[model samples]
Target: MKINWAEDLRERVHDLAESLGNLFVEGFHYLALFAIGGITAWASVMAFLGMVEKGHISVDDILLLFIYLELGAMVGIYFKTNHMPVRFLIYVAITALTRLLISDVSHHNGPGMGVIYVSAAILLLALSILVVRYASSQFPSEVSAKPRTRRHLVIAQNRAEGDPGES
Candidate 1:
């Protein structure tokens, strides 16, 4: 038997490099998630404190907090599952647009065409959310699906025992 030292060494080197690269990428992902989570938490707390200091909480303040809550939830989900939830983003956008509309109405004497435009945008976002949810339910991603059990061991055992039709 002939042993190829250079080929074996190359394969080992390739595996090591691949492992290091994966490790670095995973580490960066974790670090970035932690930073994002921390910043979101800090900002949320600051906003809450500011509202408290003002001694009055408005609908806008509550909506802002809800936005922060959604962001925090999004970050946590991404950190755990490594998948982004598009619905959460849509929810945030809807809340933000509502806030903008309310702000505009309260500041101005009357609602303008801008209110209609914002409302339309919110409606579109809502429809997109429904479509996304329906599509996800109809055709789930393979990566998100539960892993199927392997039958290789049972098949191999059946073959070794000379059992016909077991496999």
Candidate 2:
């Protein structure tokens, strides 16, 4: 069998271009994540302080803080795992929608707009959860599937080699 060097070279060049494009896109995503994270962290801190100063750290304010915490955690998770959990974003959206509904309940003239909005938010959250559940059921997390430590790998290798006594 003869290997086509020219075809292989062309394929390699195409692969390199695709990889570079992906890298550029990922870099932009990271930058956007950091920017949004910084802004949310600052806003959360300020809002928390404002609530404290006003002596009104209500349930809604606490929920807002939870949203902020989730946002920060989402950012941290992105940095650690290079992937953001859609679940967190859905939670944030649900909280935001709830907060809006609560704050505007008194002034809303419509009959079921608040209910509709809240229901929509709940539906979105449920859909996100379902998608994540389905994806994970199909492709479980690496943490559950494989040992991440070198020591664990060494132990497994020793066990495979028939060294039962090695602790």
Candidate 3:
């Protein structure tokens, strides 16, 4: 058979372009991870310094440290497995709400609208954790050992909620 050199060249160029695109995306991912890690480290150090200036650690300081630690862990997990769970984010948010609530009670004149908002945020984060757990169990990506898609989880959740057209 006569060779189609032009078609072969085009296919090779396409594959090379795809590979370069993937490489660039992966490189950007790692760069982001490193940037996050560095920023978290800096924030943790600054928190520690602030605590020192205050002569000791307070509840708010501790909570802030925990938030920073959670952020670092989130980035680390994403770098390692690329399976960063939403639960980590929810946990961070709950901790932050707790911190805010504490700050509001201590620093404000009295109980104000901030308390209500933070309390509601904590409740919402808790509910989100529950929803995430249910989704993981009902449509387990780990147990099935198959390539699961976000569409699967959303469709399943919508079906269960009687909102078939949600997606």
The numbered model that scores best in lDDT is 1
Q: State the lDDT of candidate 3 residue by residue for 1-167, as single tens digits.
A: 34688866776687677667878988999998899899999989998998999898889999999999999999988887778878999999999989989988988859888788889889988998999999998998753444434445667888998988545
Q: Which residue pairs collide, candidate 1? A: none
Task: Give the per-residue lDDT digits (tens) of candidate 2, residues 1-167.
Answer: 25698866776687677667878988998899889899989999899899989987777788789889989999989877876787888888888877777666645756586678677877878788889889989998666543234445667898999996447
Task: Looking at model 3, report the run of 10 residues with the lowest lDDT sum.
Answer: 142-151
Instruction: Arrange candidates by lDDT, descending.
Output: 1, 3, 2
lDDT for 107 (candidate 1): 82
Candidate lDDT (C-alpha), each: 0.87, 0.79, 0.85
Per-residue lDDT tens digits for candidate 1, residues 42-61, read: 99999999999999999999
Off by over 4 Å in 3: 1-3, 142-167
Question: Model 3: clashing residue pairs?
Answer: none
Winning candidate number (TM-score): 1
In model 1, the runs with Cα more than 4 Å from the true position are 1-3, 144-167
Q: lDDT at 29 for candidate 3?
A: 91
- TM-score of decoy 3: 0.78
